[model samples]
Target: MNADIKLRVSNIDKSFPGVKALNQVNFAVRKGTVHVLCGENGAGKSTLMKVINGIYRPDAGEILIDEKPVDIKNPIQARSLGISMIFQELNYIPEMTIEESLCVGNWPRDRYGRINWKEIRKRTKELLAKENLNYNPETKLKELTVSDIQMLEILKAISYNSDIIIMDEPTSAITNKEVEVLFQKINEIKSRGACIIYISHKMDEIFRIADEITVFRDGCVVDSRPIGEYDLETVISQMVGRKLENNFPKEEIKLGGEILKVQSLTQKDKFEDVSFHVREGEIIGFAGLMGAGRTEVMRSLFGLDPYESGEIFIKNQKTVIKNVKSSIDKKMVMLSEDRRRFGIIPVRSIKENVALASLRKFIYSGRLHEEEENKAVKEFCEKMNVKAPDFETKIESLSGGNQQKVILAKWMVTDPDILIVDEPTRGIDVGAKYEIYKLMTELAKQKKALVMVSSELPELIGMCDRIYIMSKGKVTGMLTRDEFTQESIMAYATGTKIQKEVK
Candidate 1:
């Protein structure tokens, strides 16, 4: 029963109609320790977390606090019992102030049931400082950038005085600077005798902050060990049930035709002089740390953002693309990094989101072919292995990995010649990541040019045929399969050099 454990998730099982989301999962978090949860997609990591945080009630098993059995009925119940969670997907009222978000459901009330504004603001201010975060409690969420919103979520969790905190890829969208601040805050919270259930795919971040590690694979716990008991290789093997020999495929393909060539691509403050050429059947990886203007470069290239001076060429012929429509017309599509914000529609069904970009083909004179759309969605779901009861299921109902698969299926259905996947497997589990990697390889086999922007160094080395390292809006160095090394990429990404030749 793990009597000393602050939170014990015992023999939990949960399922949807067609998929067993979680099966007999047991997890625990010791008091005042950073317990990391590692798993491949479909492993039930999120489901287990959802159970603990009262987002989902398990069909079987019980959760215990200090060796006593307790059933978590809802989020409020979990919070009342000193448990809080921050989702990987951010959800907050954009127009609301930071203080408003922190004290919404659990607001301090006066004798007559009136909200105590003074007390709320004071608590908000104190919590933000505890993390060394510099944000006004009155700042609206909408006005702040993605990084700012992430920090606010942490502050809100801290403000609740939660004993156990669950952070699911909390730093996925934040910049490197912001990530440093987040790590500092996490350490501070740990020092203050608070427990954190850290969930992330980023190995460095996991090792840096976690006091102990637990790996989940195929909806089961593989092992739990002290943080230093295993190195990256061992930890990864435990997570996936196999040692990862090649994180990147790094296959050699013939450069028969110049599929895409950018000449002097310039987007005012985003990116400049971003000139590069991608050949048919080649995989070009745009490698950089967070905030290195990688996504900006892809957006500009895809015509989603306005570029001041850039001549794009397809098959050595110049063309002007000023918007998303033109880029699609040119057969180049982007699988956005921010899946929730720019990719999937939460309210829409998986069928609708997948068929969105190319709806015209399925529509005739304002009359839609519902049968055709349904068939297409079903086929794509099968092809991508998107596990759901049916394509009619709301996109939000699917797990993170399934949602990601649906997005990839969306872009692939477009049948584009050039595919730019910005962090395609960012928040997914190890199993899902391998599937994505295989999909990318298949794309290369079909002679389609691919541009991948990734934060994980191993992924870049494993998947890319040739890697271009970017640092602060500029190309720093290019590495071939043989020269694909993390230190080399980090050296360039950190701006230790302008441009260097790799031997």
Candidate 2:
């Protein structure tokens, strides 16, 4: 361990053509300590981390490793400098096996530089075991779930014998059990004198694992304090610049006519015998463990997947939602679980993306209503409080939270009869998440029904008017607002609830 500092980044400045991403940013990480980079989305957290890990070269300022300045021009150079970064959007070769993906950059070669398949698999298997990840080394990345592929990425960084590891929203797409395993691995690395920069929007995690907390806002450091100096409320206020008096603003919703009613919605092995009713002015929550098929059920309902047989009713009238187009035609919209994969279109402008699903509504014959569309987008952007250069700006430039807002804007523009949100607040920050919850509340107030699927227990319990627990592709139990409890939900979700208590 260096007596002075393990890593120092001073007055760092980075810009992306027109946008000044980072401004006079100062950051440091001590050896063998967990330093959390805390901030709302697009507060230059990612930019600063990229500067330190060599993804982006700073236009100004210096990065010092062990009291000496160094130039990290590329990822290879960064790896050579004993630095590794795990990005929020994971990078993996899906066609290759786990071992093959890990050994791609620098494989164990025989005397003639030929590939040594036997040694490669052996070492990869042993390394995974040491990290306590149970999976076949030869398992194809495509065959593995998204969570397992993420574990492989982490192991790949450790394989480089890195001393400094930067993790950005590492647990965003992971399961609860996988998170425990990751924390254990992080501790092992810390014990060996490694510095870890943990970047996340979840304040609970920062307080739990961080030695020091640094909050960033608008491309500058707001506070750099020891972990004990902050609590969840204090940290959230610093990050979002507000007191989170009420996280969920769910109000007493009046029961109204049924907006969506599904009868025997079955999707074969994924989810079977699923039946639920969502009334106007209510939030219906679907709760389950990671692979209990909660998301699958929602997707099936939204016409994103093929269902064997089912009948969907809207306003007491039967409708056919054979495909995504038909679903939208029926005035039903879905916010997907995986944002990058299904939710937002990265390459298009914010206005274009938000107005995509319902473009035909504004255009007549061969002409388009440009003014009306802009006015609509402007109104939605204001309603959602989206921060962006312009509605014409590309969706990729905004932070994860803002991108989510754009998705919400798009669905809201469509004016759906029933809204199905799957992991609506997956990677959004605290303030933005609360805003989304409020939006849902207001939508319910407008007699718009919502069916939400979430992994966060508090979210389901706090935001939903009613909760349905699913297990192994079946609806094990349903709980009303009065009966909602973590223990009860878990018991039902795991097939341990009595038949009589299910009602």
- RMSD, each candidate, Å? 3.3, 2.4
Tell how far residue 478 is off in model 2, in angstroms.
0.9
Per-residue alpha-carbon lDDT of candidate 1 for residues 310-428, written as tens digits (9 for 90 to 100): 78998888988888888899899999987767788999988889999878868997899878877777776787788777887898877787788999998887778999999888777
lDDT of each: 0.82, 0.84
CA error at residue 278 for candidate 1, angstroms: 1.4
Those runs of model 2 whose alpha carbons end farther than 4 Å from true positions after fitting are 1-4, 91-100, 104-143, 498-503
Show model 1 residue runs off by greater than 4 Å: 1-3, 97-99, 108-140, 217-247, 363-380, 500-503
Predict model 2's lDDT versus the native.
0.84
Candidate 1 global CA lDDT score: 0.82
Cα lDDT tens digits, model 2, 95-188, are 7898898887777899998999999989888888877678888788878767677767776776676889999888887888888878988898
Candidate maximizing lDDT: 2
TM-scores, each model vs. reference: 0.87, 0.93
Name the candidate that leads on TM-score: 2
